[model samples]
Target: MRGIGYSLLAAVGAWAFWPTLRDLAEKWQHDPQYSHGLLVPFFVAYLIHRKREDLKQISAVPSWPLSLLFLSTALGCRATSAIFDFLPLDGLALILVLAGAVSLIQGKEMLKTVAPALGFLLFALPLPYSMERWLSQDLQHLATLASTYLLQAIGQPAINEGNVILIDEIKLGIVEACSGLRMLMTFAAFATGITLLIDRSWATKTVLILSAIPIALIVNVLRISATGLAYVLLREAPERQNMLGFIHDFNGWMMMPVALVLFGIELKVLQWLLVEPEKLERVISFPIRREMPEVPARKAA
Candidate 1:
């Protein structure tokens, strides 16, 4: 009976969300910014798998009221997405539908247990076009500013002209493509996944997640600075354009590793600074005996 019910739910969900899923898959393939979306589903599945034991402990007592609410909201989102041609809404609707299904079939405890996995699905969805464009432009400007400062700090004659940096008479444009938004989004998602999987205090998790933004930005700035330095130092090298292009692409590929290294350092720092409550309690509860000097016995004699 449970198998039949699950089969029916899966069929209905697949049929209803086919369009949304198709669009998401295409974006993951074609959109560089959201290419990380390709890995998110697998990560979500892994998260659910990790929670299977905890899930087994919870008895299924379907919550009709909450399930109805979730399903109703999902239906409304789907309708709105269809009416307005909004893809994000479709993604939200899909998540809501999943939540509703879990609530209906496995109960609210199961829903709560799997909520993080469901929420993680949002990382796979693309931002709205307007928001993405605005953010890209802002990040481009910031990157230009930071990279120019870095070049100047290292004794290069650098000037920031809006989104372009002029150093040693070479123009490096911080185009939207170079804005580092992709790194930021990808790192943010990576951090969130790590935070979910790790058993850490909420403070540590929060710090880890928040640190993604600055780490991504810093790595991107370093990349831009290195490119500028390479251009200035090798201005007269033969096939200079080809070399610079290769450097640019290589730096882009290396950004994630650099960010990961920075994140690792952050985790170490957090570990050093933030003591767990249980450990703190043990330390406090441990007895510290102070032995009196043996001179007291001589004095008594």
Candidate 2:
């Protein structure tokens, strides 16, 4: 009976959210910045699987009030999205509906157990247009500034002018596409997923997630810098244009692996710096023996 209820709920959810899911899939396919969205569902499934035992231990106690509240909000959001033609709102409605379904069927304890996986779904949704544009511009400017400085440091006659870098007579435009926002978003999602899966202290998990930002930024900067170097080095070759194009695309593909290596290094550093509290407690509890007082006097007596 419980399984039948879940199946019916799943059917209703899928039927209602079909359009939203289609739109999300389209965005993931068309937008480079959100390509990582494609992997999010699989990761979420894995997370749920990891928590399956915990979830099984939690007994269902449906909450009528909470379920109604969430479902009503979801319906409102869905209607708003239809009126405004906003996809993000639709995505939000989907999340809320899922939450409502869980509350209705399995209750709060089950929701808490699966909250991280549910929250991870947000990464699959695209940001609002205004926010995405603003982020792109800022990232472009930062990448240009950092890349220019790096080029100068390496003895290249590079000058930053807005989002474009001038190297001698050549121009390297740090356009929206080269802004590194894609890498940042993808890496952040990856880090968060890893943090949720790993058995680590909360502090360690926090640091791991936060560290993704700087690591992503640094990797992006290196990629831009390398591209600039390649441009300079291949300036006079007959195959310069082709070589430059290849290098640019190749560096773009390499960012993730480079970021992963940096992430590993960070994990190692965190391990050295932040000993788990449980481990620390064990160390503190470890018995220490003091040297026994000399028995020479007793022997003499």
Candidate 3:
């Protein structure tokens, strides 16, 4: 009966916040950079499910005080949103409301049990417009500079101004879409989810998450450099004007897989360096064999 009651409260919370969630869904559907948003919820759900047995062991004592605090925070968000016209605040309020509902129904234990999953949901929410633009512009500039340097290193005549790279008089622009921010966001979330699932040390998890930054930057650099080289190769082919467009789309799609491969390599290196040799031996070593000693020589003597 108590479980049913908690479910009802959760249902009520979701129903009340349906409009906000619907709006977020629409944003995720329309935004390419946030396309990964659609996958985040499923991952959160999976994480919660993985913790089911652990959660079941905790008592659901009603946490009225925490519930009140969370409710007030949600209300505050709504009030702030009304005055500031910030849509992200509305999404934040929903998160708080969900947290409050969990606290109210199942108490602190349940809330804590699901906290990481709730935190993961933050990745699905779109960032503030201004912040997203600022970050994107920074990534675009970095990608341009890195690509130009790489091109020059390879003996390709390349010059960059702002986000545009001029190679052999072929101009390649690193637009907002090519900023690699999307890769960073997606891979960061991916790495987080992976760490949560794996039984690894905090240090390993931290390194894994931090590695996403360089991995993303390097992949974006290679992508941009590839585009520059592609332009130089195909510049004379007037009939293949659409070739660059195809290359652009292909590289955009390839970024995630390349990031994943790099991350896998990082994981392997970490395992090699940090994982105990005894564990590896247990996993891969053949059953211990009794080595026949030359002690028989002593008896002969």
For 97-161, candidate 3 gives per-residue lDDT tens digits of: 88988898789989998999998888888889999999999998988898999999998989998
- CA RMSD per model (angstroms): 2.1, 1.5, 4.1
Better TM-score candidate (1, 2): 2
Q: Which stretches of candidate 2 lie over 4 Å from their true place?
A: 297-301
What TM-score, over all chains together, does every model reach? 0.95, 0.96, 0.87
The runs of at least 3 residues in candidate 1 whose Cα sits more than 4 Å from the true structure, single-residue gaps closed, are 292-301
lDDT of 1 at 35: 98
Query: Across residues 4-48, which tens digit of lDDT does each residue of candidate 2 receive?
Result: 977987898899899999999999999999999999999899999
The number of the candidate with the highest lDDT is 1
**lDDT (10s digit) by residue, model 1, range 1-301:** 9899899879989998999999999999999999999999999999999988998899989999999999999999999999999999999999999999999988889999999999999999999999999989988999999999999999999998788899867998888988999999999999999999888899999999999889988999999999999999889999999999999889988898898899999999999999978888999999999997776445555
Q: Which residue pairs collide, candidate 2? A: none
lDDT of each: 0.93, 0.91, 0.86
- For every model shown, the clashing-pair count is 0, 0, 0
Model 2's TM-score against the true structure = 0.96
Model 2 scores a C-alpha lDDT of 0.91
